[model samples]
Structures are given as structure tokens and as C-alpha cells.
Target: MTATVTAPADRLLYKPEDAAEVLSIGRSFVYELMAAGELEYVELSRRCRRIRRTALEQYVAKLSPQSH
Candidate 1:
């Protein structure tokens, strides 16, 4: 027997650090992407921001194709 678990569709927000982990990149790179307007995020306040999972997926999809 096995169980299949999945995340909720409404669960989309993630911290920049979490995004970095997901992308296997440095946290500073995530900030740089934000600064370059390449990654989309929502500012909750003057010091709080959250990146949407959908945005991350879209960003990956928009990247240039990798060479073999």
C-alpha cells in the first residue's frame, strides 16, 4: 500500500530563502533576481516579502534553454 499526498492549490507563498532552496541557488541570487525584476514577489510590509510558487515555476519556464 502507498499514500499519495499533495500540496493544496491555494498554498503558493514562499520566502526568498525557501525559493533559493527550491531553485538550488544562493539566497543572494534570489535577491538579485528580485532587484532585476526577473522574479516576482509580494511585499507584505516595508521589510516582508513572499514569493509565489507559481511565479517561481513561471520564472523557470521563461529561462533560456540549457545547452547539452
Candidate 2:
């Protein structure tokens, strides 16, 4: 038997590393994007940060040719 996983409807939370993996870019680039305000993030604590999955999807959508 195989198990299937599904994402939540809201999908508004992601770890920095997970976000980086989803974008297929370096973690450093994720920081750069966050610093540049290209990606929105939430600071959970002094040493923790998270990105919004919906925001990431929106960002990608904006980059699509049809969106431009």
C-alpha cells in the first residue's frame, strides 16, 4: 500500500530550508529574496524565520508570462 500526502488549503507556512528546496535555489538566495522584499517572511523567534507558501506561489504566478 502507498500513502498519499496532500498540502493544506491555506498553505501559509514553510520552513526556510523547505522554501529554498521548493524554489530549487540556494538557501542564500532565499535570504537575498527575503532581504529584498521579494518574498514575505515571518520571524518566529530570534533564530527562526518562516515563509508563507501562498506568498511563494503568488510570487511564482507573478513571474509567469501570462501574468506579465
Best by TM-score: 1
Candidate 1, which ten residues in sequence have the lowest lDDT sum?
A: 1-10
RMSD of 2: 7.2
lDDT of 1 by residue, 20-67 (tens): 887888999999999999999999999999998878877877777557
Candidate number achieving the greatest lDDT relative to the actual structure: 1
Per-prediction TM-score:
0.80, 0.71
Per-residue lDDT for 1-68 in model 2, tens only?
22222336666688878888777778999899889998889999998899887777766656634343
The CA lDDT of each predicted structure is: 0.82, 0.75
Q: Where is model 2 more than 4 Å wrong at Cα?
A: 1-11, 64-68
